[model samples]
Structures are given as structure tokens and as C-alpha cells.
Target: MKIGELVKQYGVSVDTIRFYEKQQLLSPSARSDAGYRLYSNADSQRLGFILRAKSVGFSLQQIRELLLIEDNKAAWQCADVKDKVQLKMQDIRQQIAELEQFYQALAKLDQACCGGALSATECSILTALEQGKPAQPETHQEDASC
Candidate 1:
């Protein structure tokens, strides 16, 4: 089989397959005399693993470590993999917390800007953003409520 055929079967583009090979997420197949890659059933199966892992939001570096861990599965058990997963979950949780903080800050700014047709120079949202948000903002909820 060829790379193109395997990619089509997995609903991925040919460039994506090549990129994965370059990224070390997929290994290159043996080449013929003319230097064309000769993909085998094993390559297809490996590609399937790469695609599924990517779908789960694993980073390329994480995927590389996972592939290394998987290839040495004879020496490593499920507990080893679980430990790695737990660490990645910790990193993801931190990111979610930071994003939520950002969202809440923006929501507060939106609340302050609900004031309709205020003087542009005195606009609370613009002023807070330009000067960096203060501990308190001008109250606009008194004027606009929905």
C-alpha cells in the first residue's frame, strides 16, 4: 500500500501523513529501488493509533513519549501510563483555570460597558482596558438592566 491510500482510509490528507512522518509520530516505510515508499499493513495500524491519539488532544511531544512508552510496554505496565496521564491532566486543569479567570474578567468588563452612549473619553471599559483594569469599575447596571 501507499501513504496516499492509507491516509484516504483514515480520512486524513496526504500532507498530514507526511507531516506525521517528519514529526516522528509515524515512521517511514521501506522504499523501493525507485525510492517510493512501500507502506505495509503495520504502517496503517500505526497511523490509526496516531490519528486516534491526536483526536484526544495529545500534544506531539506527549504523543512521542506515549509511542516510546507503548513500544516498551513489555517492561512498563498500565500504572506507568496512568501516571503520565495524571500529570497531563494537571497541566490541562491549570490551563482551564487560567482561561476561566480571563473569561470572568471579560464578563465583568462587559457588565461595566452596558452603559449606553457614555462620553467616549469617559467610557469605563475603554478606560479600564487602556489603564489596566482597576479594583473597581464605574457602575452602569443602574442605567441599563435586562
Candidate 2:
């Protein structure tokens, strides 16, 4: 298939496909006499893999390594794949924890503000930000809450 056909079929932008080509993630099987890039079913499958890996937060380098393993599946070990997955899971967990902390801090600030014609100087969120501290909850319950 042609590059244009690949773009339409995958619902991905032409530039993104081009970028993947430049990154050495996807390569055309052949070029037509008219200079158009030509792809095979194998190339299409590789493109799908690249898109799916990226959607799940794999870096381009990681995707490239995965492609290498996929291309040489005869010598590939499942343990290597498991290691990569574990690292990704750890990073995701860390991100979630940080986001939860930010959410808690924001909630505390929101709860502190009454929002009745308060000036910027009196805004709890603004004051907390200027003080470089998260606003404390007005009432601390005995049980842990976020």
C-alpha cells in the first residue's frame, strides 16, 4: 500500500507516519517508480505495534527495543519483556501517587475558601501558593482522608 492509503487506513496523520519512518520505527518495503513509498502487510503490522506501544506510554527507544525482540522472536525471552513491563508499571504507580497528593492539596485549598466576594489577597488558594505551602484542611478527621 501507499503512504496515503496507510494514513487513511490507520486514522493517523501523514506527518506522524513520516516521523515514525524518520525514527526508524517503520520502513517502507519498496518505493514505486513514481517515488511513492510502498508498504507491505508486515509494515502495516509494525505500524500498528508502534501506535499501540506509544499509546501505552512506551518511549520511542523502548518501542524500538520491543520491535527488535519481536523481529527476533526465536531468540527473545519473555523475562526481558516482563522486566520492561515492571518498570513501566512502577513509573505509572509513582505518577498516580503524585497526582493523588496534588489532588489532596487542591481539595484542601478549595475547602478553605468560602468564595463570598473574597479579594485575591484573602483567597486561601492564592495565599497558600504565595506561601509555597499547601493549604491545610480546616478540620482534620481522625480517619485518614484524601
The lDDT leader among the candidates is 2
Clashing pairs in 1: none
Number of colliding residue pairs in each model: 0, 0
Q: Global lDDT of each model?
A: 0.79, 0.85
Candidate 2 residue 129 C-alpha distance from true site, Å: 0.7
Question: Model 2: per-residue lDDT, tens digit, 117-136?
Answer: 53566666777888988776
Candidate 1 versus truth, CA RMSD in Å, comes to 3.3
Relative to the true structure, candidate 2 reaches a TM of 0.85
Q: How accurate is candidate 1 locally (lDDT)?
A: 0.79
Give the TM-score (vs. native) of candidate 1: 0.81
Task: Give the Å error, residue 36, model 1.
Answer: 2.7
Worst 10 residues of 2 by lDDT: 137-146
Candidate 2 regions with alpha-carbon error over 4 angstroms: 137-146
